[model samples]
Target: MIKVYKSDKAPEKLAEAGYTCDEVKQAILNDQKDKCYLCERKVTTDYQVEHIVSRTNNKEKVNEWENLFLACNYCNDRKKHYYDDIPLPNQLEFENVISQTINLKTQKADFRISKINPQLAKLKELLDKLFNGKGICRNLMENRFWNDFMSVYRNFLRRVAAYKIDPTEENKQLVIEELSIEQSALGFKYAFLNKDAELWSEFQDYCKWNK
Candidate 1:
């Protein structure tokens, strides 16, 4: 079960400690640009804010900068309601980290759910059973959820190459201005830095935008 902190009224103190939606949204963009921990998706104009600590179980974590990430719409859709079933205010319901290893040559990814709690492990198992090897539900065979993700990123590099643009420095700033990414550049040491990672390709395109 999980314990969520939402109420009819948000306490005054929550308002002051970077609780407002605006303050937190800025923080989220910076983090997304830093590195997409989930799908390793690049922080683009088309990313969705994801709650690291699911809102259903942790209200304090909800909208919290450290609790959020910039995700493309595709990953969000694949991950929708993943933590919704778990009850609020309990630790067991949350899956902190899900590990996946993608095979570049075969284009197949193997995965596992990781967390300190056994309950979280079970949840990870269920996802792994459903998402491992074959990839997401009915459309599992290299469909929109997977291949499109790779295509977008590959095209991103191609477009940059074709236009003769260097994405390293400028890309970060664009994310900051458009999505409010952080001003600091960590020089790509972060996990999200490498665009070639298997998991990165799996979910990077998930952040596409119509605009």
Candidate 2:
């Protein structure tokens, strides 16, 4: 997940037409980069205007711009009326707080706290609940995670194939840089390719150099 910035001009309350207001929808979409705040999944047309703080707990904040977020139907349904005290993505640095590892064979992602901080630990726990809780069926959740993982993994494989055809240092470096960025956002799928251990090692070395 990434930190989404809200626009200053956003409406203070839901429009008279209710949640279907084009202006509010456009604003939320713009702020969220057309991605769900929780799962970081791409959301095009079908998405929910989720409430970061549930209306059941705080009705006053229901239409507040800061409390509104874009969410996929799966996440929205799973998160309905649930409120956790964990820090919101906009309130914390996402990349620094959480790290994810993926099993290439299963395509299941395991989220971990990236640092020793207490707040980050709480964030990790909250993420675990959202991802692995009983709200969604286990098989469905795994499939969703796997689909997102493979979408990026397939692209990584294509890059590797291109590099194999023209074994140039520049081509290899390009793949490394791209994969490093993808690994940061989509977890370790690209970095976990055991079929090309030498190439993966070089990518790791490049990551360390850049860090």
Across residues 69-186, which tens digit of lDDT does each residue of candidate 2 receive?
7888877776676544456657765644566555557535567675677766765665666555554555766566657646766676677778878879888875776544324233
The global C-alpha lDDT for each of the candidates, from Candidate 1 onward, is 0.41, 0.63
lDDT of 2 at 141: 69
- Misplaced by over 4 Å in model 2 are 12-20, 115-122, 129-137, 141-145, 157-211
Residue 27 miss distance in model 1 (angstroms): 1.9
Scored by lDDT, model 1 comes in at 0.41
TM-scores of the candidates are 0.43, 0.67
| Tens-place lDDT digits, model 1, residues 1-211 | 0111222333344457644455455554443343343344465655666665556666767645434555555545555555543222222212113344445576554444454655455445434433342334436442554574455444443433433354455654443332222211111111232344643453234322111
